[model samples]
Target: MTSFSPGRLGLRAKFAVIAVAALLLGGVAVGYTLRSTPEPSTGPAVTSDGPERRTTGPGGPRLMVLSNGVRSSVALRDPAGPREVSSQRCERVYAAADTVACLAPAGALEGPKLLVSDRHARARESVRLTGIPNRLRVSASGRMVSWTVFVGGDSYAGSSFSTRTGILDTEGGLRLDTLEDFRITREGKPYRAADANYWGVTFAADDNRFYATLSTDGHRYLVEGDLAARTVRTLADNVECPSLSPDGDRIAFKQAVDGDPAKGWRPAVLDLATLETSRLAEHRSMDDQPVWLDDRTIAYALQRPDGVNDVWSVPADGSGAARLLVPQANSPAPVA
Candidate 1:
């Protein structure tokens, strides 16, 4: 693997980026562009670590996946801050800068409110199509939020994941589910695989299309879901829990092609322009989810096989070695 240093790139490499951006200046149709702009992953680390149940201090915001199954939020700024979610079983949680999003069990909701202000715990904001929000992602700009909600069963209905792309606006009218409602697979059966699980939803800097990792099996198979186009396609195999780049062109994910589940999931990246995946760092045991610290550096939680997990960051170009960022926390979530 080659280490890409923005400071040391040659003229030809710099020119290529400019050329790609120039062609991309005009609105190009979703799958028609000749080249994808190599975006810098300059944003908050996605799901840095799971939220700690017993949090301390005022240095950060904390989220709790409650026992009642609902995910609740508490701001450390105020020791007596109001709780965020009252009743949703928190399946997954992600924070984009200051705004945070989570997957909650539909049954945990007290009313029809789907969105809320992460700043103000009690305030109800916008609501989307009815269903249980099992996978959630917030954008870096906090202007767009998207989640996969299932409209079936009483709780975790065992339903396959469906796409719901949304844009947040100031007027606060009905949420924009899509730019234009379109279909992907024609005359197709709805995807409701028993184990068709969706995780790792992320927002690009532009907040246009969202990306997630969906899998039927953890071995040599992973599907990338395009939230805006209403399509799901194969991008990389043997990969799961992918986080998108801030500029939105490349992706950082974990792959376990060796079939060793414990040591299988290691940090990797896919350059969209070339459709090439570079494995940056691989631990003997499975590493936790990986997120881009910048276009060139990635930070992730790594555990000693079946041991504890801690946060670490390394250059994406694969030059600099992985450096420990923080000590082991049950689940760590980093704020930008």
Candidate 2:
């Protein structure tokens, strides 16, 4: 894997690097391009007139999303209605419990950073990091936060891309800068590899146990990790961007079409105990991580050909059709 130093690259060089990487990665450009240009409002106009901007608290269920680049929220019951927009800008964001995690937009001469904030959107902590932001997640209890970034390549389907995934304990201040430092067990034996790349982490309710995608050699596997033990063991193959369901009995993940990344990915659900996989009804290729809106439904961002995104939801049991939940929004994080 090649190393990338974002701080050392100029703005033009950075874009050039990404453009070239995208072409080499089978013409699937980085997901950021889909969000670069702002699109027309699809529903009611967003407003900042509301006092319930906080992600979590004594309010009705709301869904946190990125309206263009700014942090915003919409009522879960009426997603097409007006929204409360915030001043904070993030490349990727997620909220759970009383905590919110944001991947601050990267600058030409600066690397991306992790910004931790409270439910009220107050900045609490910031950690400097490298690479372009790709994925971010906050544990259900809001105590653990994890993120993934692209260090070299752009798309997950390409072999040239290098990734760095990290975890931070908000309460204890324990940080794992890279999952590479943790021990890995593959096929019931000690595993070690220079090509190992971990990403798309989803934590269990306990926060001690987690699941993430481990790509090595040429295969992608879903691995169950123990935060306390600092170890991970392979559970299944061809699972990427695993998002644990609210009930914790299953995981919503993107599975490569026919076990091939060049073909794209399909949203699927895996029963943890039975290890059975059920493919969802949505046939379109979804590159974003699927977040569970509840135990019975899953939400994810789908990008159109012209660089526009909309949040879509599908039944977790593979029974219902996919429907647009929020238009002109990305990074759907349900906050109750």
Candidate 3:
């Protein structure tokens, strides 16, 4: 295991990054071309130990998974006077409606533990995970919670990039650790492989149906998963990190460039009914699964020129230019 710094490196250093495992937003492999343009300064300074302030926004309540190296806190999105929901150190956080799920890794070398908490960050139910949890999401109705973790390996090792994507039925007390048991079909035929790994889950409003990224035998594909039948089938190739839209008819995902996973991906949206995909105007490698700000706009985290991660938004239909939404925020959960 080697150390990874998110700063820009020369060609020699980038080649080194490919060898040693690099951590992306969802704990996926990092192999994208760096964006050289400087991001415009818009919000307040991102301080790890800053005090809470109150600022107004359009949505109901803005949720941010913030950490100051030693401690992680869930704070409201107000930059002027942010409000604290909890003082727990979480690696990732997802909030929707009245449900907030926090992914916390127990020590420096321990596995992850997930806590389903209230809006005030009170733990209502908790569960231990089999791996290091990275991505967290809640269904539109807040009845379903899904998470993805790098299973059986550490983030620093090349072999540890394999993932286990899981879903928890909060109302039913049902938990599926991995989708490997789900019946799988590739190109409309039964495809079985022991190397299949799933990650980056995005759920629909119905809660029973969802989409995710499945990797097997050196290839990645966008998969449609059904909760009731416990089955999944590949929908398309070269798709990683599928995020369904607010209307449940479209999906925003990352498309691998030039059929190469290591070359990085472009953010795009797919109309589920039409099977049509349109690339957004971000024009940079996005490592995080995007969150829908509304039906028309989507937000995602990108490493700025200052090396810290910030939230940015673009039109879902690939029409408008990208704009900075929140500064120094890694995980953006817009509560409505």
Candidate 4:
């Protein structure tokens, strides 16, 4: 295993190392059936008159988040309001429909694991895994789940790290331990590379189509995938961490600044129909997978100087200023 220190690498090299590490590695997927268990809850209770009583307006939708590693949630209607925290700790988490996926925190003597649960926090399934969890996502239909982890090395300043990404079909009980097994087509021609890496997967509404980032050589590309066929085709270049809009017409992604990772990245939106890109109002470098709060709004985490992360939102059309949505929270996913 190799170790990388961000402080020793230049801005561009730091991101390059991270992007490369996030795209490499291969592994096996182990699956297990989980027995239902109650998860203890903390924080303010949602009483009938509380801010979380309704599912809209003053109560709006529920926004799942990781509060200092605890699985917590807040009402979108009152994002700054009290949160309902759970005892289940995770390094990364995401929720959709009835499914909630968590990358359980590693123990002193044990490695990290993936836990699948229901909306009420009832465990459904668990998978033993390796590496440090980085990203997690659930399909809109709750039938598919995916995750990414750093298998070797640490930080984003060096080329010593490797990444592994996996996907699971909850309904079919099929697992793809690594995207490397999938055939790839670049520029309408078969492509192969031992150093190819893939990560930041975002699924389509159909549950069969998906998208992810593929890094090889010195280039990064956005690849559209077909789960059943186990094939992926390059869609565009310099796109990373793509989050498809609810309408499926646009993709919210992180674009390497000026076609150079050393320069950092900017949050931007891509119109799938025209291949035109729209850079958001946020000028700061964001190293996150943007989530769609709705068809018109995109939200992502921004780390503050104090190392605390806050969820911020900007208009997907690139017309409005960025605004804080949730303070002291990250890995946001909207749930009803």
lDDT of each: 0.50, 0.88, 0.72, 0.83
- Each prediction's total of clashing residue pairs, residues at least 3 apart in sequence or on different chains, is 16, 0, 5, 4
Deviation in angstroms for 85 in model 4?
1.0
* RMSD list, candidates in order: 24.1, 14.7, 16.3, 18.2
- Runs in model 1 deviating more than 4 A are 1-92, 102-116, 120-136, 146-196, 216-229, 259-263, 304-308, 330-336
Candidate 4 has what TM-score?
0.83
TM-score of each: 0.52, 0.85, 0.76, 0.83
Across 1-336, the per-residue lDDT of candidate 4 in tens digits comes to 888875778989878877776655321111111122222133343322111234333565878887777777788778876776666778888999989899997899989999998776677778888988988989999989999998886543235667899999888999888999889999899999998888899999899999999887777899999999999999899998899999999999999888876677899999899889999999988889999999889999999988989889999999989999888888998988
Off by over 4 Å in 3: 1-63, 67-85, 108-110, 152-160
- In model 1, which range of ten residues has the least summed lDDT? 39-48
Q: How far is candidate 2 from the true structure (C-alpha RMSD, Å)?
A: 14.7
Q: What global local distance difference test value does model 4 have? A: 0.83
Model 1, 233-319: lDDT tens digits are 555556656677766778877766474444456677888778788877555433445666556777665655555444566777657
Ranking by TM-score: 2, 4, 3, 1
Candidate 2 off by > 4 Å: 1-40, 44-59
lDDT of 4 at 274: 89
Span of ten consecutive residues with least summed lDDT in model 4: 26-35
Output the lDDT of residue 203, model 2. Answer: 97
